[model samples]
Target: MHGYVHKRLASTAAKLAVAPSAAKAFPPPDAIHNPRTFEPDTYAALQPPPASSLSALAHRLGLGLILSPTEVQQACTHSSFVSFYQKHYPKEPKPASNANLASLGNSLLGLFASEYVGASYPYMPTNIMKAVVSGYVGSKTCAAIASEIGAAPLLRWHRTPPTPLSPAPLLLHDALSSISRSIIALVYQHRSLPVTRQFVHDLFLSREVDTRAMFKFRDPKKALKLLVDKFNRERPISRLLSETGRFSNSPVFVVGIYTGADQLGEGFGTSLKMAEFRAAEDALLRVFLTRTPPEQLSLPSSTFSPTQSELYKPRKRPEPEYIPGEIGMEEMLYASSGKSGYLNPTPSLRD
Candidate 1:
């Protein structure tokens, strides 16, 4: 519920068209991994995941990523003794068998759903069972079917299981669930739901997804440009990221610039800079327009900076000077404009 609310708020906020700085005032954590150096994952195994959280059901469409253990626990905790002695911690003197039985029941539901779904789809291979089971449960179809079939008998064991997880592994329902889930996973793979190259760039920019290589995008130039514009410094974007593959030699990095307009032109050394040069060589597009011709005015030096507004005040033109032999044409123009004796304003009139 919180995540969904967050997304809705974010979308509405973005449409408000506020400036970037304003949005930064209240930033939300991205879904990807954060790149910042932080503490070790000391309690990683104990952390419940987001997908399993009850709140995610309101937001996630089930087609998205799976939930973490934490999320799962938050969504559902199947403790059998809800109102029993365990509630007071002293009511039941002994441990209850109810919790174990419930867990086994859940496992059985998973297995039975897997089997029913598998039989309907003969083309699916054995490996696809897990995915199918997941789909069935996610769709809530199997739960409804199990309720109708009266699944309680399927969960009973000849002997009571010692602990919660003990009988969970041996149940027929658990096996069916695994098969159904495998099928679902298979379907997702068939639809090409794997991680993407562009996603890596989004991850890098937000610092949520970290890569060993500085320039890790499939097209390294995008990475370099981001570094150039943001970092405003030249550094090895491609070579830095490619260092990750040095030991394994995976095609984890590509070095070179783009040459063509929209397609990959050519690749050179692992340097993103050189690749950019090659791209620039292929097509150089530019636009130039000349302004109206004006007097060639002598201007201040380009590097000059004004300390105050007064420094930029425009200088007035010098008054015209007359030599002793100079002829005055003001009288003739004065007559042309039909002015009385004065051709132009006198010194007093000028003042």
Candidate 2:
């Protein structure tokens, strides 16, 4: 029995020491099933997106230039997917994720949103302006914008393996918003600041924010009176403009807010007190929510134009200059007809 065991051990050692006489015609199959091997064509979600798919995505996003395969994939890849992939393929180099890129994009988005909001609504209160900025780049709004532009479906995210019960992880608001910002960052990198600004305006800033609805007034009448005093204006007074069904249980009262001879705002309510409150609220809204006309709107960032093309080649001629201007408080205060109404403020050029 000892002799037989020694002979068996010797045979195994000799077999291990011997090299292959010749290579096989085909590579040997993997010890474990690899998705890349089994489904090369269907491994896009797990790998970098193809240039063609990325081109389509760029076209959908109104991007004039196509991003490189690496950039688009990085923008779309969530960190969760990278972690899952790393867990599965420990030896392979970890795939690039959008963690850093997303952070950069978030800052870029905030800068653009804040500038656009500030330029458009010059008289907007600081708190209300902040909320408006949030609405432009906030997770919920970003996700919704991504969905609108068909970016949601193009996002490559899969934390869990595909199964009947739980096929993949849901694309949450944070993931979607991160991708949106990442894509914007990529646009800024590949394209120019002007292009990125235009893209931001067309996609995010164009969404109308109801500044009127965002106001919260504990005492609108008192607030209006205070605002009037702050502007060195006369005291605000609410006057009954019209009333219907005065004797009935259900009555409607139209009230107007006035300071001196100028009527600031009007509102309708069921009760006299409610009408007066609404009128004051309307007056406050008019003063605080004034916005520049779309055509007249100008952002400081508009001064920059791309000096080079997407390929980084110098332009044949200089790009057209953009004159920067903003609506100051003086402009928002007085109207063309010298009326106190807020909708259309008279333009006054400042040296």
Candidate 3:
């Protein structure tokens, strides 16, 4: 029995050595293993997005400028996707995540927001300006904007676990927003500041923000007084202008806010007190929400020299005339302290 078993083992070894396909199945021991020898057909989703799709997305976004394949890939790639790639393709170089670019884009968005807000509404309180900026490029707003631009389908990421209340099971709002920021970062990195600025403005800042509605006055009367005092004007006085249906349940009262002989603003409400409060709020809005004319407005970055930049082209034409902005006065009258009141204006812009 032992002799028969030894002979069977020897015969099998000889047969395997003589087989034609055995060399292909078992390569030389010294040969380096190449994972690419076989196609990674199993993980089709791990592949980079096609150029045509990226082009279509760029067209939809109206980026105007072209992005390199690497830039586009990096911008659209999430960290989860990168991690998955690293795990699967251990021997291959790891792809970079959009986290760094998103950070850069976040800062750029903020800089542009502050400069634009400050110039456009010079007297707008600091906190309100921040709120307006957040309204434009905030996480919630970015997700909505990205969705409208059809960017969600282009993103490459591993589906993260969703919160109980989240609408998207595969994606988070922060991740969605990061796509926009990363794209913005790529635009800035590969293109000029002017182009980047235009891209940001056309996409993010172009959305209309209700400057008047953003103002929530905790003490409208007191704020109005502070506002007038900053201008060296007389204290605001709220006077009942007209009234109708005084005996009725829904009595309408019209009140006008005045400083000296000039009427600051007027409002109509169900009661005289309500009318006065509204009138004061109206007066505050008129002063704080004054917008610079679009034609007269100029961003500080617009004057930047293209020659100084590494990526941008040299300027062929003369620069536009620069218009200096007026210094803004402080009137810390908005509601931000508690649940409703806004914080005070920035110290630099205040009296």
Candidate 4:
């Protein structure tokens, strides 16, 4: 058996050696072992430009001039662009992508939004708080803001052949939002927290949020019940504040929701049930529509000293002061509408 196997192996080797395509199948040992022969030349086309060019791009975005050229370039460069570049230029080193920067920016935006909303509206329900944060930093809003500022046009994308009737690519919106976040991250990296915070305020927080409209209760009465239970308060009682023209074509009923001596909210409607629902909604709004003065708002990052020689050093920062006042949805709306006689001045980062 051993002699037969040895003969078979010798025959196979002889046959392979005599084959016409054997050279094609296996190259010379030196050729096969050479590392430099197969190596490709390094080339990366979409590398970030010089500091002057990046600063020009930043100026186009209405940003105050700073010296974070590479960061700004990376912020604008999407992963799709990087992938495309790498695919076409296989030998080139992979350039920096915005994924990490976008992630960091997203976290920072969420943190700032949560801190602002939480401090402003301490008693706001969890669901409402989430909605508010979404309004500020959600993709839809970010995309809209990006497009409004012409950042969408400035976004770098991989060039591909256009197909007829192809589904519209979502990369534009995705890239725009990413670029926005990356820009924020870049600012935070190059500058101090206070500078980044100011940038966020000017860009995002300055926009007025419709706190009342944000509330979408499927059943206001049920929600009110749950809220009362959570607070360990007496069940809410709806009382008829007033009524007029009950038998006429036009009827109005004013209802108020109360718990013990505290009147939660009041509403006017055409019927008792409608008035009760409106009152419940009003009560929920009252509970959720708390606001703090912009000057008094505190950020969690303030607890850490940016000047610390070592990491995780606690700093002495003044605690945020909470001033109790209605959010005044109507006033905020009017102010947002650019109308005269608006009671509340628009909140400005400069303030």
Clashes of each: 48, 0, 5, 0
- Candidate 4 per-residue lDDT over residues 1-351, each given as its tens digit: 344433443344333222212222222232235534422111112323345545666886666466466666677678777777777559978878889989999998898887777778866766667888988887777777766765554455564445576455545576678877888888888777767877887899888888788666556776676566556688899999999999998999999999988999898989999999889989887766766667766556555444434448654664444444443221122211222343432334113
Which residue pairs of candidate 4 clash?
none
Of candidate 3, the 10-residue stretch with the lowest lDDT total is 23-32
lDDT of 3 by residue, 1-351 (tens): 344433443344333222212222222221223333422222334555556656667777665466765666677778777767877779988887898998999999888888898899988888788888898888888788777877666566777676678666655677778888988888887777877888889888988877667767677786676567667788778889999999999899999998899999999999999999889888878878889999888889878655443348666766766778887885364442235454454454345
Candidate 2: give the clashing pairs: none
Name the candidate, 3 or 4, with the larger TM-score value. Answer: 3
1 against 3, candidate with superior TM-score: 3
What residue runs in model 2 are displaced by over 4 Å at the alpha carbon? Answer: 1-52, 62-65, 158-171, 308-351
Encode model 1's per-residue lDDT on 161-213: one tens digit a residue. Answer: 45766744344344223222322332233232222111211211122211111
* Per-residue lDDT over 1-351 for candidate 2, one digit per residue giving the tens place of the 0 to 100 score: 344433443343333221122212111132123423442212323444445656667777766356765677678778877766766568988878888988987888898999888887777766678888998788888888877766665565564444688565555676777788898888888778888888888888878776666667766676566566557788877799999999999999999999999999899989998998888878878877777788887777776666655657776667666665555453223221223344321233210
Q: Which ranges of candidate 4 are over 4 A from the true structure?
A: 1-54, 60-65, 68-70, 86-95, 158-171, 229-235, 248-250, 311-351
Output the worst ten-in-a-row residue range by lDDT, candidate 2.
18-27
Candidate 3: how many backbone clashes?
Answer: 5
TM-score of each: 0.18, 0.71, 0.74, 0.64
Q: Top lDDT: which candidate number?
A: 3
Question: Sorted on TM-score, highest at the top, how do the candidates line up?
Answer: 3, 2, 4, 1
> Residue 121 error for model 3, in Å?
0.4
